[model samples]
Target: MKTWLTRCLLGGLLVTSPALAQDDDAPYAYPEDEPARDEQQEAEEDAYERRRRQVDETDDFRRVSEEEGEEGDFKELAGVDDPNIGFAVELIGGALLLDSSEGNFAKTVAGLGLRATWEYGRTFNLEPLRENLWADLRWTYGSYSDGTDFIRGDTGVHYFTVAPAYELKLGKTSLGIFGQLGGGIGYQTTSITIDAAETKVNGIKPVFQYGVGLRGRPRLSNKLSLSFRVEAMGFRRGYLNDIFLGGSIGTAF
Candidate 1:
């Protein structure tokens, strides 16, 4: 009986020891001690303030990141601080390939023209690709003197076109050259000169053209800035038109 009692007492002590330890470790004071209670309350309040400050700091960091993203990290990487919108005027030249078929031999006619482009800022908030959109307007003239055709005359055209273009910036580099694509409609007319004296004029017609090319502009201040591009243009109609591999260079504003 004594042995069983002793064993019971030992088991009870083991079970109660942890609870006793926990109670001893906790802060203890008389209920009448208001100063001790106030101190504990103040400590809790200080901890809460610390937590709130941490949250505010985190939120501030997030806001800064979003603002930086809108400003474009690409500009920083490329070292280009140009405005979102820009304008450029170019002196352009290219070959005019007259499709002289039906027992007529063909030749490449090189010509010159003026081109203007507008960078219309990023219409979309999406980064990179949308940022490179541009509007291109051009008026050009080309002449081809053909001795191989039945006409045996000079063929020429006056083309005015407006096209929307997009640039794909390959890398973030100052003065970087990148690929661009554009296509749009225009008005064109044919001018034919025979034997250096007689001239034939064709009526105005609608023309379609698309081009792929490399384009680039330097980072410059309010002074005259230089820009350049090279492209191969294709025409859907108006064989009297020009599909030329050409390049342009001029000032950008």
Candidate 2:
């Protein structure tokens, strides 16, 4: 019985010795070098924080870029306008003499005059006058017959005239009444044949004219317009002592 008790006591002591050894090593089982899980968790959190900061910075840059683009577009739209348009016209016509200091000359005397005109001007207010004022220059040619009692009988006189004038607007459509005043220099040439005798005479004179007339215009295209004007004027000179009636139709460009 004593020996068996002693063996039992020895086995108990062995078991207790092993339990004491395990308790002493428990504090050193988890070392600072073996903290792999904690290190991994901290590293993951740091990476996540870095990624979040990058996302925030990218969004801030995107917003700033959008604002700058809008500002650039507004600055490109602020300077200068367009231009105004204009044109000129030329009218030509036949002329008739209306007065005579020489008697019974209408049935016996023959006369004709040609007129050339140039007009140019532009709109002032554009709403009030598309074409405001115009300047006109004219050339006239005329021929007439003489009576039997004159020194050079069975003969005639020819006249040439150059006139400069101006016109003001009374209305639109080129079909309206207008008043004009102008003066110019003239030249006269005479030819006579009596009893098989021929003679020639020439002279220079100054001329004055006043007229009121109507104009009618028809449009052909955007760059071209056709116009007509009827005008009358008085002429007094060594060659002609009469009033003249005339009409003209021409193109404008």
Give the total clashing residue pairs for model 1: 0
Name the lDDT of candidate 1.
Answer: 0.66
Off by over 4 Å in 1: 1-84, 101-105, 123-130, 147-152, 174-199, 222-224, 238-241
lDDT of each: 0.66, 0.56
Candidate 1 per-residue lDDT over residues 10-114, each given as its tens digit: 999888845334456656777786554588889999999999999999998667555545556622222134353567899989886755645365467776788
Task: Write the residue-wise lDDT of candidate 2 on 24-51 in tens digits.
Answer: 6456654765745688889999999999
Worst lDDT window (10 residues) for model 1? 74-83
Each model's TM-score, in the order given? 0.56, 0.51
Top lDDT prediction, candidate number: 1
